[model samples]
Target: MISQATIDTVFETARVEEVIGDFVHLKRAGSNFKGLSPFSDERSPSFMVSPAKGIWKDFSSGKGGNSVAFLMEHSHFTYPEAIRFLAKKYNIEIEETEQSDEDKLNTDVRESMYLVSEFAKKYFHDILLNSEEGKAIGLSYFKERGFTSDTIKKFSLGYSPETWDAFTKEALGKGYKMEFLESTGLTIAREDRPFDRFKSRVMFPIQSMSGRVLGFGGRILTNDKKSAKYLNSPESDIYHKSKVLYGIFQAKQSIAKLNNCFLVEGYTDVIQFNQAGIENVVASSGTALTPDQIRLINRLTKNITVLFDGDAAGLRASVRGIDLILEEGMNVKVCAFPDGEDPDSFARKTSYDDLVAYLDTNAKDFIQFKASLLMNDAKNDPVKKADLIRDMVTSISKIPDRIQREIYIQECSRIMDISEQVLTSTLAQLVQKDITEVGKKVKQDQKAFEVVKNESPVQGAKVDVLYRLERKIIEILLLYGNKTEEFEDVFLKTNEDGEIENVIERKEYKVYQRVYLSLQEDEVELANPLFRDIFNDLIQYFLQNENLEIEKYLMHLNSDFAQEVTDILMEDERVVLHNWEGQNIIPKTKSETIGQYVSETILTMRWYLVDKIIDELKNSVSNEPGSDNTESMSMAMDYYKLINSFSKKLGRVMSRYS
Candidate 1:
C-alpha cells in the first residue's frame, strides 16, 4: 500500500547497479556485469546483469528478471519487504494502507511461514523479558556470557519456560496454525501431545540473510549427561542448515566494509566478536563448512580468516573447512588462539586491538598453514610425508581457477620440499579423477532422467533464444527505460486528390514506447512469472508517464520487481575512467570493430529467423496441399511480412547501437 509517489521517487533516485552491488561482487563483462550465481553453487559466473537493461539472468538456474527479481532470489525478500528496503535505501517514505482481515487471510504459504517465524521471534522475545522462568534462565545465561542487553536483543535471544506446552498453548491461543508451529520446529508433536521445542532452554534464533527467523538453536542449562549440550531446530520450510550461516545478516555489511571475514566455529564466537567491536565475523554454528555457506560468505567478501582453536583436535577438524574455502576461489588464511582458547573465550579475554594484532601476526595463507601443521607430524617419515603431499594435491585440485590453483601448487611445492612438476602432475591426476567422477554422475543422472525433457541443448547452452532476447530487452527498459533516445516513426503520405495528407513531423521517442513497439512485432511472451508481472506493471507505468525515467518507474514495480530493477541498475561493474579531461577513449578503430560485430550479429539472428519461417512455410505447403491453396499462400505472405518487419527493426537497432 505504499504511495505511488514514494515508489516513483525511489525508482528515480535508486540506481540498480548501486543496489545490487551491495550483495553481488560484479565484474565488468563486455556491456554487462557478471558474478557467481547467488541462487546456485557455481564456480564460473553465470549470474549476468545488464546495466543497460536493468535485469539479471542466472543462466545456470534459468531464472531471469530485473533487480527486484535478484533481491527475491538472493535474499528471499517478499514483494513488499523488497520495496520497503529500496525505499529505505533511497530515503523514500512509504505510505501503506492497513491490511484488512480478508487481505491477511490471502497470504501465500511462503509469506505465512515468514509471518509465523516473525511471530515466534516476537513471542520468544516477549517471553524472555516478561516470563519469570524466561528472565531467570535465558536472560541470566546470556548475561553470564557477557552479552549486553543490546546484543541480546540484536540477536533475538529468548527462552521458553520450563513448563511443557507453555509456548505451544500461547501460540495456539493466539490463533497461529499448529501445523506451521510444528513445521517451523517451534513445537514438537508426539501422538496426541504437543509441547514447546525449546522448553527450559536458552534460545538462539537462527536467521536467514534478510533477518527472518528460520529456526532456532537452543542450549540446555542442566548438566545431565544424558542430554545433548545444544539442540537445533529440525529442518523446516524456512531453515536449511547446510545452506545457511549463523551470523550472515548481522555481519554482511561489516564484512563488505572490511573486505574480509572471520569464520568461527560457534554461535557465541560470532556474538563475542561482534560485541568486542569486530563485526565482520560469522560462524558455521559448529557444522562443517558447506559450499552453500562458503558461497554465502563469498558474496560478502573475498577474504576469509578461519579462527581455529589452539587444540590439535580442533585445528585438525577445521582443516577441511579451510580447503573448502580455498576451492571457492577465496583468499583464505588461518588463525589460532592460545591453547584452551576458542574464538569466543579469546575475543572476550583480550582487547580489540590485541585480538587484531594477534590475528595480523599469526594468520597464514592456507598452503603455508596446512604444510607447517602437517609437516610437524611427518618429520623423517617418508610414508607420512607422501600422504601429506597427496592430501595437499587433492586440496589444490578442488580449486576452480587455474591461476589460483597453479599459485597454490607452487606454494605447496616450495613448502613441502617437493618438485613443482611432481606436484603439478599429482594435481592434474586429482582433477582428472574428479572430472571423471562428475561425468559418471552426470551420465547416471541422464539415465535416471531419460524421460524428462532436456531443456538445455548442450547442457549449458541458451535454451530459448527469443526468451533471452526479450528478457534482455526488458532488462534494458527496466534499467534505462527513462533515457531519451531518438527514434523514427513512419507514416504514409498521399497527394491532394482526397487520398491522404503529407506525413507529419513528430518528436516523440518515449523510451518505454520504443521498447514496447520493438517487441510488438515479435509477439514475445515473458515466461517468468515475476517478469510477466513487472512487464504488465511497466506497461501501466508507461501509459501514465510518457516522460518517466527508468529509475522513476522502478519505484512503482512490485517489491520483488523493485529488487530486480535495483540489482540491474546497480550491478554493472564498468569502471568509469576518471580524470579523462583530454583523453579520447572512443578510438575510431575500436568503434569500427564494435560496430561491425553488432551489425553482423543482428543480421545473422534476423536472417536465421527469416529463413526458419520460409522453411516452415515450404514444409507446411508440402505437408497439407489439399487445404485452400490461396488461403495457405496468403498465410505464407503474412509470415513473410512478419519476418520482413523484424528484419527492419533489427537493422534499426543495430544502426542505433553502432
Candidate 2:
C-alpha cells in the first residue's frame, strides 16, 4: 500500500492544469482553462479547468475532479496507479510496503498486460543493443535507414531473435504469465505450444499518451514471399490500434506547444521526421484514419497537416483523412512529397531546414489540394469536371463550421474558375441533404430514448424530488460550505412562569457547520446512497482538516460518486445561478442571496420530509381503522401545520392534502 504521507505529497505537488494540459490543449478563459471535452466527442469547449480550485469539470461528460482523478478517469488508471502516475510526474518519492504473493496473483488483467508489454519492450531493446543476431540484423537495418542510436532509443526501437520461442521461453522463465504475453500478442499460443509472434522483426513499441506500453508494431527484415512485411499487435484490452496514434506519447507536448499536428502514414515516417527536428508528428500506424485517433490528436491541437507521399494511394489516404479531421472541427492542410519520396525517405535525404521550408511552402488547404489533384483528371471533360465540383462541395459540407465551409467554397470557386453563386448553391444542397439525414437519426434516437424512459422503474416527480433535493444539498455543501455566514437559530426555553417561550438567537457560523447542525437537529439525512456517503465524507473532512481543499476532496472521492457531484456542481452553468433583476425579479445576486438560498433549500427539504411523514401516517390510520390511530392523526395534523408555517416563511404554497 502507498503511504498516506506520499499520497498527500503527490496531491500537493500535482497541479491540475499542468497534469491535464499534457493530454489536452487548454486555453485560458477568465481564471479557468477551457477546452473540448476529452471524455466526449464535442465541437465546442465545455471542459473547464480551474487552477485556483485545482479541479476540472467536463460538462459534456459530467466528470470532474482534481489532477489525480483526471488521470484516473482519462487514462483508466486505478486509484493506486493514478497516485503513482502523479507521484512519478511530480518527482515525488513514493513510500510503500512490499506486496505479498497474493497481491501479485490478484493484479488486474489490464495492468498485467501492461507489465508484460513493458517487459517485452525492454527485452527486445536489450536484444537489439546487446545480442549478436539483433545487432547484425535489427540494429544494422535501423542504422542503414539513417537512424542514429539516440533516435532508435527515443522511439524504443528493438528486435526479436530469429529463433522461434526464444522470447517466449525467456518471458515465461521470468515468471511473467503466458496468458498476458499471448494476450498482448508478444507470444502467439497455438494448440501445441506458444511461440513468439514477432519473430526476427525490428520492434516499434506503441505507447499510450501517458507513456505506458500498450503494444508493438514489428517490421520484418527478410523479404520472404510468404511472410507479411509489417505485423502489429492484435486488439487487446489495453491497445486499440484504431484509437492509438503511433507517436502520440512523444508528439503530445510538441503538438500542444506548436498548436498543430503533422500527420504521416508509417512508423518510420514519424520517427524520421522527429529525427529531422520536426517533433510534432504522428502516424496512423498503417491503419485507416479513425475518428478515435483524430479525437486523440484533437485534444492536443486543433490544426493538423497531413504529410503524404506523392503516390496515388497516399493521396487517396489524405482525401479520406481530411473529412475525418474536418468532422472533428479541426483545420486540415495537405502536403505531398515529390514522386518516389515518402516522408521517411525525404526527411532522411533532405536537410532539416530544407525539409521544413518545403513543408511550409507546399502545404495547401484541403480544398485546394483536392481541387488541384482532381482538376487534371477532370480537364477538358465537362461531365467529369461536374462530378469533381460535386465532390468538392461534398467535402465542404462535411465541415461543421459554417464560416470555414463558406471560406473553403470561395477558395474552391476561385481556383476552379467556377461561379461563387453556383458553388454556394451546390454546397447548400449538400448541407441540406446532410441535415435531413441527421434529423432522421436524431428522431430515431429520441424515439428510442422515449421507449426506454417509459420502461424505466424510476420516473416522474416522485423520483425527481428526493434526488433533486439531495443533489442541491450537496451542491450547497460543495460551493458554500467553507464560508462563514450569519444564521438565525430558533429554540424553545422555559420562562420564569414555567411556561414554554419561543426564543430566537442569531449567530455567525461556517456554512458547513450550520448545515450539519441543522441536519443533526432535525435528524435528517440524504436519501440517495451516493449523496449520503459524499455528505458524510464532506462533514468528516470539515471536522478533520482546518484547511478545506475541495479539490482534494473531489480527487479522493470514488470515481462514480465524484462524477455525480460534478454533474450537480456543473448544473448551475446551464442555468441562471442568480435571479434576474428585472420587472418582478429579485435584485439580490447569488453571493448576497446564498444565505437565504441555503435556508430555503433546507426548509424545502424539511417540508418534503414532513409531507412524506404525514402521508405515511394518514395511510396508517386509513388501513387500521379498528386500531387506536388518534395519536397518528394528531401527529399528521401537527406536521401539516408545521410544514404550512415553514412554507409560508419561505414564500412557498404548501398543499397539505396533496
Candidate 3:
C-alpha cells in the first residue's frame, strides 16, 4: 500500500502538461494546451490539458481527469502503478507500507507480466554488456551495424546467450515466477523443463508510449536457413504487436515538437534515423500497417511521411498503407530512397542535413505518389488505365474530409486526363454503395428498447423527481461548494388563528456549510447511493480542510467514482470549448451565476420533498376507509401554499407536481 503523504507529494510535484507531454504532444491554446486526442482518431485537436486546474480532458472520447487519471487511462496502468510513474517522473520518493498476504494475492496478472518483461529487459541488457558470449557476439553484431554505445544504451539493447536455459535459470533464481515468464514469452515452458525464447539473438525492447517494457523483438545473428531472421514476443495481456509501434516512447516528444512522424519498417530503421539526429521516427516492426498503429501516431501528429526502401514490395506496402492513413483522416506523404537503399543504409550513408533535405524535397503527397506509381503499369492499355482510375477514386473516397476528397478528385481527374464529372460520379456511386451496406448492417443488428412492465407509475415518477433534484444538488455542491455567498433562508411560522406566515432571514455562509446544514436540518439524504456517498465525503473533507482541490480529491477516489466526477465536471467545459455559443446555442455558465444557481437548486429540492409528502398524503386519503383526514389535508395544503409562495419569490414555476 502507498502512504497518503507520498501520494499527496506525487500530486503536488507532477505537472499535468509535463506528464502528458511525454506521451502526447501538447501545443498552447489560450491558457491551456490542445493536442490530438490520444484516446481516439482525430485530425483537429480535441484533447486539452489545463495546468491551472491540474487536469486534462479528451473531448473526443469524453475522458478527463487529473495527471494520475490521465496516466491510468492512457497506459492502462493500475492506480499504484500510475502513482509510482508520476512519483518517479517528478523525482519524489515513495513511502510505502508493507503489503499483507492478501494484498500480495491480489496483484494483477497484467502487472505481473509487466514486471517480468521489465526484468527480462534488464537481464538481457546486462548480458550484452557484461557476459562473455554476449559481449563477443551480440555487442560485436551491434558494432558492425554502426550502432554507438550511447544508442545501444538509450534503446536498452540486449542479448540472450546461446545456452537453452541461461536466461530461464537466472530469472528463476531471482524469484520470478514461471507463469509470468511463460506468459510474457520469455521462457517456453515444456513438459519437463523450460528454456529461453530468444536464445543467441540480440534483443530490442519494445516499449509502450509510457516507456514500460511490453515485449521484445530479437534478431538472429546467424544465416542458418532453418531459423527465421527476426522473432517477436507472442501476444500477451500487456503487449499487442499490431497496436504498438517501435520507438514510440523515444520518438513521441520529437514527433509532437516537429508536428510530423516519419514511418519506417524495422527496429534498426528507427534507431538509425535517431542516430542521424532525426528523432521523430517510428517503425512498424516489419508488420503490415494497421489502423491501431496509425491512431497511435495520430495522437502525436496528423502528418505522417512514410519512408520506403527502393524495393518494389516495400513501395507496394506503402501504397496499401496510404488508404488506411486516409481512412483515419490523417495527411500522409511518401518518401523513397535511392535504388537499392533502405532507411538504415541510407541514413548511415547520408549526412544529417543532406538526409533531412532529401526527405523534404523528395516527399510526395500520397495522391500524387499513387497516381505516378499506377500510371507506369497502365501505360498504353485502356483497360488497365480504367482500372487505375477506379483504384485512385477508391483511395480518395477513404478520406473522411469532404473538401479533401473533392480536391483529390480534381487532382486525379487532371492526372488521368479524365473529366471531373466522370470521377465525381464514380466517387458518388462508391459512397452510396458504402452507405447502403452500412445501413443494411445497422438494420440487421439494431436492438429495441426493453421496457419494464412491472414498475408503478406514481412511484417511478416520485423517484425520478427526487433523483433529478438530488443530482442537481450534488452538482451544485461540487461546482460551488467552496464559495462564500449570501442566502435568503425562508422560515414559516403559524399565527394564533392557525394561518401561516413567512419569515425570511438573510445569512452569509459558505456553500458547503449551507448545503450541509440544510440537509441536516431537514433530515434529508440523497436518493442515489453514489451521489450520497460523494456528497458526504465532500462535506466532511470541506469541514476538515480550509481548501479543497478537486483534482487531488479525485486522486484518492476509486476508478468509477473518479470517472463519474470527471465526466460531470468536464461536460460544461467541453461544451464551451466546442463553441456552442458561437453557433447561437447558449449553455448555462455556472460560475458567473453560481450564487443564484445554488440557492435555487437547494430551494427546488426542498420544494420537491414537500410536494412528495403531499402526494403521499393525497394517495392515503383516496385509499383509506371512512376516517378524519381533515387535519392531514389541511397540513398538506398549507405546505403546498408555502412552497408555491417560495417558488414565486424565486421567480421559478413549480413544474414538478403540476
Candidate 4:
C-alpha cells in the first residue's frame, strides 16, 4: 500500500552493503566485500556484497538479489516489512492508499496477526510512557534496575495497568476486536468478558529481527508467594517460545562485529550485560534453548558463549541447550558465574574489564565443562563414567567440521581421563551410523524416483528434440535477445492452383527466421523456467507500450522476475568497464558486432540439426512407393547444400573468436 515514490526512495537508499552489513561481518574483497553466508554453515566466505551494483550474491546458496531480498532472507521479513524497514532506515515518509472494507476483511491472516501485534506493542508503549500508573510503576522499576531511559525506550518496555479492564477498554475503543486481542495474548477472555492479560506487570516487548513485536515478557512486581513471578505471551502465530530469542535485533550487529554472541537467561541479564559494555548479548528469557534459537544466533556469529548461573540446578538446566548449539556446528563455551552469583548480579558488581577478563580466563569448551561437571557424580562408578564419556563423544560428533570434532575429542579425552583412541573409535562408529543413515535416505530417494517414473511414460524422441531446441532458444534469449541486427528481405512468387500467387514482402534473417519458424512450425517455446515467464512478459510489454527502453523492460517485471532477469543479464563477465573514460565513446570495432557471431553460431547449429533429421527421413522413405533414384539423389544434394551454408555460417561465428 506504500506509494510508488516511497518504494523507489527505499530502493535507492537501501544499498546492499548497508543492509547485509547489519547482519554479516563483511571485509573488503577488492571492489566488493566478502562474508560467511548467513544461509548456510560454512567457515569460508562465500557471500559477496557489491556496493557498486547494489546487489549481493551468495555463491553457496545461489541466492542473489538487492537489499530488500537480504532482509527477506536473513531476517525473515515479509515484502512489506522489508520495504518498511528500508523506509525507516532511510527516513522515507510512507503514504498508503486506503483499502476498501472488503479488502481489509480479506487481508492475509498472518499479516493481520503481525498488524495486531504491532498495535499491541504501541498500546503498551503508550501506557508506560504516558499513563501515570505505568510511569510510576513500570518506568520506575526499570530505572531502578539500572536500565537507562534510552535502553528502556529502545526495547519498548512498558507497564500493564493493575485494573483488569484498562487495556481491553482502550483497545476496544480503538476498534480492535476482542478476538485479535485474545489471539495475540494481549487479553484473556472469559465467559462474555475480557481482561488485560498482563495487568500490573512490567512488560518486555519481544521483537523479531526486523523489529516487529512478536510477543512480550511481563514480570510481577508484588510479593505474592503463590503467584508465578514472571509470565510470557502464550505461543501465537508470531511468537514461538522455543524459536524466539530476546534482544537479537539490538545485539545482532554487535555480535557480527565481535564474531561472538553472549547467551544469557533473562531480560535483566541482557540489559545488565549491555549496561556493562558487552553489547553482543541476548537472553533466552529463561526458556529452554532450541535449535531454532541457536540457528538464529548462528546467522549472526558462529561462536557462542553461554553464561550460566553458578547454582548446580541452573547449570544442569542449561546443559541440554549446549548440545543443541553444538548440533548447529557452532563453537560454544560455558562461562559460569561465582558460586553465589548470577550474570545479572555479577555484571552489576564487577567492572566491565574485570568481568570480561574473568570470562576470558574461565570459559571452557562444552566437552571440558560437561566432563568436569559429571566427573564428581561419576566417581568410582565405571558404568556412570562410561555413560558420561559417551555423552561427551556424542556432543563432539554433532560438530560439522572434522578438524573441530577431532580437537573436541582430544579435549574430552584429556578432561575425562579417557583414552583418545577410545573417543576416536566412538566417533568412527557415529560416522558409520551417519553413512548408513545417508545410504538409507539415498535408497528411499531412488525408490521415490522409480515410483514417479512408473506413473508416467518416458518422452519420445520428437518430444526430446523439441525440448532441447526450446532450451537452446531460451539460452539465446537470455544471452543475446536484446542485440540488434540488419537482415535482407527476400520475396518470391509461387505457382498455386495453376495461377501465379504473390507472397507478402517481409524482411528476416537467420536469428529471427529461426526463432520465428520454430515457433510457427513446431509450436516450440523457450524452455528455461525463468526465461519462459520473462519472454511472455516481454511480448506483452511490447504490444501494450509504444515507448520502451531497457530500464522500462525491467520495470514491467515483478521484483522477483526483475531480479531473475538482472541476474541472468548481469552474470557474464562480458561488459568490462574499460579505461575509455578519457577517450571517445566509440571504438573502431563496435562492441555490438559481437551479436553477429552469436547469430552465425545459432544458424550453423540449426542447419546442422535440420540436415541430420532430413537425411534420416530421406533414408526412411527411399524404398517406399513413388520413390526414385533421382528423387533420392536430389534430397541428398539439398542436404549437401544446407551443410555448406551451415559451414560458411560456422566460419563467421569462429571468426569473432579468432
User: How close to the true structure is residue 6 of candidate 2, measured as C-alpha lDDT?
Assistant: 93
Instruction: Name the TM-score of candidate 2.
Output: 0.84
| Candidate 1 residue spans exceeding 4 A from truth | 1-22, 26-36, 40-67, 78-105, 439-544, 549-658
Q: How should the candidates be ordered by lDDT, best one leading?
A: 3, 2, 4, 1
Q: In terms of TM-score, which candidate is strongest?
A: 3
TM-score of each: 0.73, 0.84, 0.89, 0.81
Query: Residue 427: error of model 2 in Å?
Result: 3.4
Question: Relative to the unseen true structure, what is the C-alpha lDDT of residue 147 in candidate 1, on a scale of 0 to 100?
Answer: 91
lDDT of 3 by residue, 1-658 (tens): 9999998888888889999998887877546788778887666778888887778888889898998888888999998999988888878888989999999999999989998899999999999999999999999999999999999999999999999999999988998899999999999999999999999999999999998999999999999889899999999899999999999999999998899999999999999999999999999999999999999998888899999998777797667988899899889999988789999999988899999999999999887887877788899999999999999999988898899999999999888899999999999998888889998877666532123323434365667777777777777777778889888877798989999997889889999998888889989988789888888888888888777787788867877777767766655556545666678887767778777888777787888788878888887775457788898899888988978876896797766563
lDDT by residue (tens digit), candidate 4, 1-658: 7777777777766677878887787877546787778887676777777676666777778777777778877777777778888899888898797778996787666666677778777877888888998889888888788888887787788888999888889878888777778888989999977888888898888988767788989899999887689999999887899888899988989998899999999999898888888899999999889888887887788899999999888898899888788878788999988898988889888899998899899999887789778888899999999999998888888787899998888888788877999899999999789889999999999999999999989875654554455445544554445444554333456665666654554344434334555455635455557667776665555446553343335434687786775565434311222323236543343235645544554464466466656667566665668766686677777866766656664664321100
- Runs in model 3 with CA error above 4 Å? 27-36, 42-48, 57-62, 191-193, 447-468, 490-505, 580-589, 610-640, 652-657
Please state the error at residue 558 of candidate 3 in Å: 3.6
Q: How accurate is candidate 3 locally (lDDT)?
A: 0.87
> Residue 322 of candidate 1: its Cα lDDT?
74
For residues 1-658, what per-residue lDDT tens digits would candidate 1 score against the true structure? Answer: 6666765566566665667777766766656667767776666676677676555666667666655555677778776667777887777778877788987877667666777788888888888888887888888888899999999888988887888898889888988898888888888898989988888888788887767778888899999888788899888667899988898878877887788999998899999999999999888998889988988988767799999998988899889887788777788889888889988998888999998899999999887888878988999999999999998888888777899899988898888889999999988888898899999999999877874656534533232564454455555555446655554455778777768753645455555666666456556455667666777777787677755454445534555676665544443332221212236453232223332333334344454455556666666674465665566567777866756665565655322110
Stretches of candidate 2 off by over 4 Å are 1-5, 190-193, 449-469, 479-486, 490-505, 527-529, 544-548, 551-560, 569-658
